[model samples]
Target: MNSVRTIFQDGGIYIALYAYLALAMIVESIYDNEAFSRWTARAGMIVIVLLIGFRWNTGTDWMPYLRVFYTTDSSSDYDSVVFGIDQGYVLLNRIVFYFSDNYSVFLILDASIAVGAVYVFIEKSTRLPNMGVYLFYTSYAVTHFMGSNRRMLAIGFVCMGFLFLSKERRIWEGWPRWAVPFGIAATVHRTSLAGLAGLMVSRRAWPAWAVIIGLLACLGLGMAGLPFSGLEWLGGTLAQYTGISAIDKLVFYTSGEAELGTDVNVALQAALGVAKRSSVLVIFIAYMRFGNPSQYAQRLYNIYIIGCAVYFAMVGSPIFQIISTYYSIVEIVLIPIIFAEIPKLKVPYILYLLVVPLLLLLTALIPYLELYVPYRSIFSTF
Candidate 1:
């Protein structure tokens, strides 16, 4: 009892979220029935809601975006002007923000996205434990932070996009319809365009070597530090074609980072960012050793892993954390699917399920430890 108390006192909301998710995962693992699994899922949802509500009254990073949404005049000229680039997300936030100035709406949207993602996971990989899916949703860093809210929505859209790709077996469709949701998601956050690229890679009917080379090229760009000097030429070409400066602006946006100052913490984050990029190398090697995964899964995982590697190598920015965020989405679905394929490894299945989520929780906590520490006492106060 005292040990449990100590854990809570030390970790605060961090431990609370982890414990709730861990418990739910254990229960889902033990009970495979849909009804019971869903009950546990609802309980997890309630916990997320309660946590969001508690955090709402206190300030958090999401407050500013929520305020922008809630307080901004829909009829004002600035609404379209300020949000012209990422109109989809801005429009959604407007509707959500209309309800309240609190950031709870963001939490609600995140939870909804999580639930949708889990449903997609179950549909694609039915053998996965419900708790494991929920654990992945809760423990991932992207879901917890407000700064990446747009990316979170993009992840939700990615889930839907994956669902469409998975359904290709039934439909005689090529890529056009399938590409739309992902494109929309990309519009929500340009970072997600990588996911759409992944979808395209999955649908390719080419030989495996091509895929291998493509993955290598992505990694090489990171390691080689691909120059953007060509951006000026590319921007001019786009300007001639589109008659709009949007593409040029995007080029300039990414290019502008080169001149920005760096700090110790940012430098540390960059180093860790590189370490995280190495996970793509790990995933690629794992893919080669394990043999080709399912077409749809291959696309999602490869795209996600390559994006993480390439983005980190190029920018060395913490924004690359967005890859880790949604990659956990892929992990939840992929881990269980991979476990299902190896019946000979039955004895280790449960252990893998438990250990992987715990590892993800630890990785997610690295960035939050500083903020989480001062608030440890707050948990006891509750």
Candidate 2:
């Protein structure tokens, strides 16, 4: 255990996990057997839950959430959640504490919900579940499932809700289906409302050129800080009258009191975001226009493109990225689908494997490695 802890402290655990995912991708690609693909996906999901769920002291919020767990009890009032955390999350703490005050259990429950929902969606919706889970793990393991517990839970519900939106056609069937999950998500994190972008893009299929032009325009808007400059004042005014703690929290962040991650070189991040998002967008849109894309992929792709627009448009806002994340999470499954459908040629496949890790390195690790590296699991310490 001490040796394992040392390895984690050296960041070898992350390297190993990345290698494991790469290996799984290789096997699934080569074996061409249903059982191997299914089991490989299952193994990957279990690894994600265990690694992230049992993380002892990691990232920024470990001690704060631990403190919350320690203080919470069955009688804890949801309305009085500290710092205006959602009632749904406070209730979750109460329920967990009712059975056991062990914080590890709470963490595991969170990992189950956050990781499980996305993986289940991938499994149910995509032909390449292994690749889908790989994308989810690589993209968000540190930033989300390891950091913001409530936001992750909310994202879980949104991911599941998308399943309904992507599949159902009837207004009566689809709206209610997604709304139930969306309601649950909003209770956990108000930003989960960003999931509505999925519904918005679902209304009509815009032309390829239109979305591209719109995205570029949003980039310009963000550069000038048009909407966000007013957003702070607007958020403050709404918080005063509405008395919704969520709005208050939003006001706090946007007011420059707490960055919660908005403090950065906006222009650089936005440009890098363009490189990352546009790469995926090009692949997805190409398939939509030139190839035979399934209705599910088409709808989800539209949502993802809107998510990119949202992110570009709100690059300078404090909490806007959180909103954009709910919309962009669609890519976990979308990218894998696009990858799986690539022509059976070695060059494209090899380039994909090379490009994905490079992209993650550029967009995620370069920016976030220090915050969440030296991955420390409770079990490792033992």
Candidate 3:
């Protein structure tokens, strides 16, 4: 309890940003006008993008990223294999560097790619765009916008491809829409190739029983501190064949360096990790099965089931958790669909609201207050 209170006290501005978004989501539920909702989503998206873009010397990895961006030039292609940076990301830095030497401009461009694409997915595909955006900030904003900038770009593009999958068009047509985007995402970060699982989920929701059983199995396996020797071998093999340095990171993260491996009270942390994911999957899947959510929401829930299964099973492995991150993003859009249908401030609605603070509380106990508190921007003293 003291730790959680300390997190809120230290991260007042950071938590307040979340509070602001939450308030907007609540207010948005009161409006029925499509035009107003559309414009409000746009306005919120723009604000989020700018907030991420304008950061100066903020975020956990900004300094490292800034160093790499400055050095990334046309001559940096061969460095990609050595530094574990992706070739496409190198090219992006080189292109942006040549056009403008300012790192702030590069930051803005990266923010546009990462944060902007998810916003696009929510606005076009979800029933409650504001709720989706707010949900995104709870965990994703700090992780993606503030760190893992390269993988975030890949996730963003993959999300764009999911947009095509969510459409009512022929299934074959969806393949064509994604090939280019998925390829581009792979070039940015190879781990995103795991996102292919999304293509396999049918538009129909999976059976409620199957999802429940699968998640329970995952929870048990994850809590056991499952090892990943085969995964380490696979990463080594991929790096050998592809000559990509970044793929080697997979091996490092899984070689007994996962949080569960290093931390004391591993069982407690492991339980919390799986519990947070299970809460959403169990609760959201219940609503998805019983409620009249749109076809798009069902599709998102289906992918989430797959993501959660992997996430829960790999709670002890950080590399595999990356795959789950790709899948779990569907919640930003899927949860909003359910939230929009429930009566305002009713039991169901309040249950949905409970989901938002779960991740925030989890983060508060770990890296959030330490890394992202006292937010700053290039344009201000903060």
Candidate 4:
């Protein structure tokens, strides 16, 4: 009975999300009103932001974040209390703590930054902003937003960075513009440095054949159990830069207790998700091949390629699942942009409308590692 109730509660949240998506689509497609569409999108955004922001006693990181907030407030020792959180986040928490101990203040601000960033990106960057919002909830919610607050906030900046990077005339030349967002993202979450690196190296799309061959090579190496020294270096660098213990991280990863692992079953699921994400990549490439994509669209395509390369290369590492999930999310916004220019490709929109709901359903049913299960909140009890 408890399980059933939990399922229903989770179902309700999913329904709410899908309702927003459906309404946005209808307003855009049937009403043909961008103004009304934006209004509906804003309303929908509020519903979700409240649902997530005011959430209490739910999400994997909820209590942890609360503890950190309080610890940061009460503790005099900086290093001991700060833990592994970035200075930016810690400072934010301290500021919030200054006024009140209430966690909602922090929650509200965090959610606003995270969700607001994406909302701004969609409104500013995409013609079909509604689709980007739909894709965000369907593709990004479970793996990212449910529990992980700090990184989600960091990702908001990363999304903004993408917007900044997309508009650049010369990718390498516009440092000051792009650097602020990416730099903040990195300071908030060191993993975003990989995104910064991706931007630097992926100035143009690699040949499709090369991408394919590289992906296959990565899979082969992962399956063969060959070590990639680069990943080790990456782990070490991240650890050193972030002031976390590298040996402790390695032990935790190898302890068979990490959320991701080298287990065959985990690998298969990670690979399957990667395969699903590649479908979008393939579509983007196809459009690029057959259509006269704009310069900006082509640049996004190149970044997507780099995302794929990083994803595939991480397959053998314990962090593969995390990297895979991170890379999988870019397509939500990228695909809409790519197809926006090619109006004749009605199939992509059709597929998006049909496919996103399935992904949302999967997210609700699988429960996304069970972190999203038993969806309780401070405001309601199911």
Strongest candidate by lDDT: 2
TM-score of each: 0.69, 0.89, 0.86, 0.84
Q: List the residue pairs that clash in candidate 2.
A: none
Q: Give lDDT tens digits, candidate 1, residues 262-300.
A: 322555555554554454345444654565567666655
Q: Give candidate 4's error at residue 32 in angstroms.
A: 3.3
Q: Which stretches of candidate 3 lie over 4 Å from their true place?
A: 1-10, 72-82, 233-247, 256-269, 344-347, 358-368, 380-382
Residue 364, model 1: Cα distance from true site in angstroms: 3.4
lDDT (CA) for every model shown? 0.53, 0.73, 0.72, 0.66
The digit string of per-residue lDDT tens for model 2 on 92-162 reads: 88799889878889888888888888777888787777777777777776567776888888888898888
Ranking of predictions according to TM-score: 2, 3, 4, 1
Which residue runs does candidate 2 get wrong by more than 4 Å? 1-9, 73-81, 174-176, 203-205, 260-267, 358-371
Give lDDT tens digits, candidate 3, residues 293-361.
777778888888888888777776655666777888888887777776766435557545656564654
Worst 10 residues of 2 by lDDT: 72-81
User: Which structure among the candidates has the greatest TM-score?
Assistant: 2
| lDDT of candidate 4 over 1-382, digit per residue (tens) | 4444555665577666777676676456545577876777777677668767777777767766777788854467656655567777877888888898888878888888888887887777766767777777766655577657888877788777777656646666777666888788776676766676545544455677887888778667666655445445555556545434445455445444466322235555556656765777678877777777666566677776766666666664645435444344566667667756666765656566666455544643353435555556677665
Q: Report residue 200 deviation for candidate 1 (angstroms).
A: 1.9
| TM-score head-to-head 1 vs 4, winner | 4
Clash number for every model?
Answer: 0, 0, 1, 0
> How displaced is residue 47 in candidate 2, in Å?
0.6
